[model samples]
Target: MVFALGNCALSGQIPIWLQNCRKLQVLDLSWNHLNGSIPPWIGQMDNLFYLDFSNNSLTGEIPKSLTELKSLISGSSSSSNHTTALGIPLYVKRNQSANGLQYNQASSFPPSIYLSNNRINGTICPEIGQLKQLHVLDLSRNVITGSIPSSISDMGNLEVLDLSSNNLYGSIPASFNKLTFLSKFSVANNHLQGAIPTGGQFLSFPGSSFEGNPGLCGTIDSPCRAINNMGIQPAISSGSNSKFGRSSIFGITISVGVAIAVLVAIVMLKMSRRGVGDVVEDLDEETGRPHRLSEALGYSKLVLFQNSECKDLTVAELLKSTGNFNQANIIGCGGFGLVYKANLPNGVKAAVKRLSGDCGQMEREFQAEVEALSRAQHRNLVSLQGYCQHGNDRLLIYLYMENGSLDYWLHERVDGGSLLRWDTRLKIAQGAGHGLAYLHKEPNIIHRDIKTSNILLDEKFEAHLADFGLSRLLHPYDTHVTTDLVGTLGYIPPEYSQTLTATFKGDVYSFGVVLLELLTGRRPVEVCKGKNCRDLVSWVFQMKYEKREEEIFDSLIWNKNYEKQLLDVLGVACKCLDQDPRRRPSIDQVVLWLDGVGTEGTKE
Candidate 1:
């Protein structure tokens, strides 16, 4: 079972223990960059024969020990293994059909040698004459400038002899006449000279097989043997051969230059526009304006930021994945950016949000906002992959959520898909609480525009807090001032309409509205008082206190045996809706209550 996997172009050094395959019959690693001296252990492969490693990056002399396989190396094996060193050992016992051929994963065998097309430049080891079972002997395409070893002629099993495209010169041994079984023989494109044998299978090949030599008379039509320059060998030294050494060095130099140029460009751009507070951390090269997972909470090992794991994702990669911000790929849109569905080059589906250019000169503020948002992490919050800043364009990358925003599935008709489950609703609330809790306590960042539109949903029905552009990260040292009000009309806190103040309590109020929507299966702030509606939250609250809770509960929640659980959820939401900001429970407290409820539900 000899394999002829030459010129594979597969990079990387071969892993060491391939010889451990005891069943290996043939191996062909020729015409590749498989360098390093031929290991002597190859002689241990007793079932090998047809060796053809003529032209490759292999270095050092041929292993003299290869002469040992006198009785074992055969020329033929399965054709499939003919192109690879790996072979699947067939199991006749597993064969249920008439013919035994079947494919399975656990089966394996190895092919024989073909380590050519390398820098193997030494003379052909005379010991190769001992391979009686050898079928294919191609030692062409090398720097070995010597006569063809006379011993090769003794191999009765040799069918293919190609010693062409090398620096070999001098008379072809008359002993080659003894190779009666040769089928494919070639010595073309070499410096070999002298009279050629015109009989046997040699007659079939024309003078072209004997080209490149000014000497060497042959019986073929060209009569190259008629030339008198005979028995001359070319220089065979392989000196200072670095392969890609020159280009690789050049590429490294260019990469460094480009990186420096980018640094200079960023500096020039920053110096031109001052007054954005001295964020000295950005200039530190050791840190490189790193992207921190703000919500990272002791999860999987892969979640932790490791210097070895990932490189800073480029803007081009993000753009390509998100279809260069195509309108057709838009999955969700927000005040600051439009989220688009995209497929990464690595075949990973992702959600990429391309923000509109900050026309009023808010790009830096927007970028800082997104950076702060991207670093924040929570189980209920969407995972931000990385962000891209390509000139005036900005994009935020997030883990692709199969299920879209909560607004779509909750408010609009699902077209007959499964409704949100009570238990799932509770989980969503808890995860959302965790995110809000982080925003409230960890950094005190207030999501100014929290609502059903911003609570994204994944396929698992988990909730993620998104759209942080309107979000304002609290200063650790100074207070932030807001003189103008901003937020959706429906979910905006009652006081926010009259006062321009923003706080975590305002977000909690909005969240309360959302919780009520989940339970009532109604839009938040719908005025259902009279025929209109008392804004879903107000109506639900009035119904709950009046002991007519079921009137507002969606049938999905009312009919289920989980009324007690839904009531607990309702109570938590009610706490969030307290009029006084001081009266409302902090998001962390809300999270704790949901966790307690989750624990209780687990018992059922």
Candidate 2:
């Protein structure tokens, strides 16, 4: 599966050459900087099972050719199988046998087509009805206009349908009552009017699904009215009659048989009572929250800082914005949990961090942490917007960085052009240092995890220190905080392994490793000349002692023009990496030195 190409700074249109990859099954190009209209040839791929083009600059009408995929159309069985571009098999062909047990040949998950969060304008193509096997279809957060298509009811297997945040007007098609398999449906934030459909899955959906559209009526609060001279009110149904035949006699026998089976089931249940309680308890403990929590924990009430656009946010809104925390919305993952790209109801965007594990004193500690972090704000620090707590699960919402993490720009080589220039690098380091200095000034605050991945970048590539989940708030009288070692493997200070304590010096050591990463364009741990893994600090010092400083620095910035500034930062890095914590310079001192380096770069 091709997943998460988002924030990779990939520009231009979808490459036409991709159409040649006939075996491609899953294609995800979400959250990228790609522009231009989607190529129609995408629908020509016979084996394509999933396609996502969300959160891009793509425009124009969705190609009607998408309906041509045979696998997506009902009654058409494809004998072919396909693998992803990486040569990983995604589907296997089933052989036809005369006397062998045969399973249904259709895809179990159902094909999904997502084209949300784009500039794609125009009416949704009526040809969409041809994709009868589609399970999920999302066209939300776009500029698409026109009436809601009644043809969508043709998709019998559709389970999730999102058409929110659009300008579509007119009554929701009453034909939607035929979608019995739909579990999640939303047409919120549209101009649609008339009576909402009743029956089938519509009965179970919450009012939020129909929110934002004031004209629409039926389930929520809007009154129903006649449309196009037809009565729009829900029709009351009367009971119907049926005739009994030989099949009725068989039904009577089946009723008696079911009664006997119920008796047998009760006896079996009584005999297995010794272990039944334990199994039920284990299930409850494992899931932690009930299955209905997704339904009950509507968007948590948002308590963002003033001037933020998400004043009207709630837990239900958060769930809907992130597609119920769908894997497709994941932008990053950490030891605690995953972070999702959350789009607020007011069209503002943010990042929502879902923490793993269970609740203990967390409910109390969570409030304290929020209070402290919210108070400790700086230009170089990421803003903690708000949080959500439901049962044992907790979520921390923050600002969404457009440029992603520094690790990605440095290691993944995603940012296009020479974006990682020496001057920019100096500015980033200085900003991060300033943030560290600001945090250290607080009452015994120690950021236990300080790595490039935790250092996020805004659209301008300015560094923002984040991910303070492992941070310890020391008492006013305490010298250090004793805590379990928690940090990325390569960035963790060596002394931390034995001391089992977190200190400002430890944060300085980790920052030094980040400086080395910036200078050398090398990871904290990498294979050396002998093909053996060596830490960056040892490798850099070894090269320095041997009079090969030029060889250890990033080739892109290793020039006489930049040697002076580079060497000065290298000196600071060496001081920060001192084996003894006492010898390490304070974060405040480091910040001053970095500011000097940045000033020197600006002068030249």
Candidate 3:
């Protein structure tokens, strides 16, 4: 059974006999007035995946035994995975069904544990890292004390982590960079101090997420003071021991003699040419290519997504599957990195993009792509299956797109004579709009780059936005100004060139350019007279002014039957391409207008 007696209003300590129900997967006892400490035996059930004890009068420290659940680490709810010497299975369940709350159920959700709004106290156990497969962990509104554990960083598959309204203290851990899949993170109303972790998911979270913690510093509002030492140390006495007097003079004399001998030996060694050559060789060895991981070991980590078939996945197996990233398996290459097609042992096909660079800037770029893809999930956005890191190598795994990118269909006639139908074109535009709208709505996110080449299509020709290496998450303080200007040439707006600020309106302008590409089927910048060229937006605007709007439509899509609907979409695209950013419509408005056009066609 998945769920036991939930919302039953039962009073008294949780019955220890529930441990005997070994097959229970979800146990939600939230929203009750039950009192007493959570039993450690609850962790003994191996097949459990969901457990909720929120909104109760439960007390005492969270059990370290809860982390022993093997299903939370291996993505499998079976007793055969983690068995104690006594042959008992370790089990755990993540339950959040308190108060009958309805949540947006995406295609998949990872193993989770929610124990919020209780009287629980004591520090979060470092042993929680044992649940490597956990995705959502909420321990909010509790009286828990002590510093946040650094071991929490080891859970590579964690996505939503909320520890708000607690008494957590100390600096956020630097090791949190390993949590590439983290999307929603919070620690508000806590006693956390020192600089906040600045990379990975930390960058995407708005200042609101870290609001109530005044001691915490970094991009968030409050700054930590310069204290000599936070932890208390034992007081030292001024009095000297009688035993120290016996060897003090003798030890000082011997130490002086040994120091002089060592100085003389160093002078002789420095005079030798062979010794200097050896020193230079050692320096070069340390500064050269990354030697952090052994080549024999292949990789250091392999993290799979929630419903991945590669349960027993390993870095060694991935390397062997790609034939060491040989050119023969190369399927695509772009500004981010090279893509290789890999067939895993469970018959799951994936596309792996190998980001190759040792520089800090490149590392940030790789992290941005992973974090953005993990956070923004829409039907029109490509899914990130997982990621791998070893030495200087960084690889991102995504579901393979069979139909390739939108650029291929527009420029290269991959399909011989059959042009994309008008309805299909409208559907692709609507799907892309949904994705862009979602990104624009995110607090700090701005997709700096949006072009045809970055949009991939599936087997059904459903559009999925791809390529987020250039995406930027502005700090909450910066309302509309950012100095770093990064985007494709033709898609960038005129206001961006002068002000160097990225805004939601700027993204709308780029999407307008994409819509124009779909309608006219022409490149952004087309060559005209020698050394001169006309941008697609300029040409379309000029044609509209000259009363020649019909001349610029794609010869294949141009027909009296589809003219009315095409014209309606063209008018919306033109409004998006308005020279003034303020005049351009919001992406949400664009979607409504486009939806109306589709509705009108259905009525006809």
Model 2 lDDT tens row, 1-604: 2333544568899998888887565676766778899888988877676677887899988888887876577423343332112322222111122121111221222378888888989898787888876778989989889988789999876878999999898888889988766767899999887688886667667788898977667863444655478656422212243234556757966998999899968953653342332121111112223333333443233345554446656556766778777656778766556788988888878988877532333343355456556657888888887666553467787889998888867765423214788988888899999998998896457888899988999989899998876677777777788765456656778787677778889999999999998998776754111222136888888888889888878877777888889988998898899999999999998888888873553221
Sorted on TM-score, highest at the top, how do the candidates line up?
2, 3, 1
Q: Candidate 1: how many backbone clashes?
A: 45
- In Å, residue 186's CA in model 3 sits off its true spot by 43
Candidate 3 local distance difference test against the native = 0.70
RMSD of 3: 26.9
**Tens digit per residue, CA lDDT, model 1, 254-344:** 9988998999789657743432332211211212222322122221111112221123344345455555555557777565555789877
Give the number of colliding residue pairs in candidate 2: 7
Per TM-score, the best of the predicted structures is 2
The runs of at least 3 residues in candidate 3 whose Cα sits more than 4 Å from the true structure, single-residue gaps closed, are 1-299, 414-417, 442-444, 474-478, 481-483, 527-533, 601-604
lDDT pick, better of 2 and 3 = 2
Q: Give the CA lDDT, 0 to 100, for residue 123 in model 2.
A: 91
With candidate 3 superimposed using the best TM-score fit, by how many Å does residue 499's alpha carbon deviate from the native? 1.3
TM-score versus the correct structure, for each prediction: 0.48, 0.51, 0.50
> For residues 21-54, what per-residue lDDT tens digits would candidate 3 score against the true structure?
8866557787678888989988887766567888
Point out the worst 10-residue segment of candidate 3 by lDDT.
Answer: 278-287
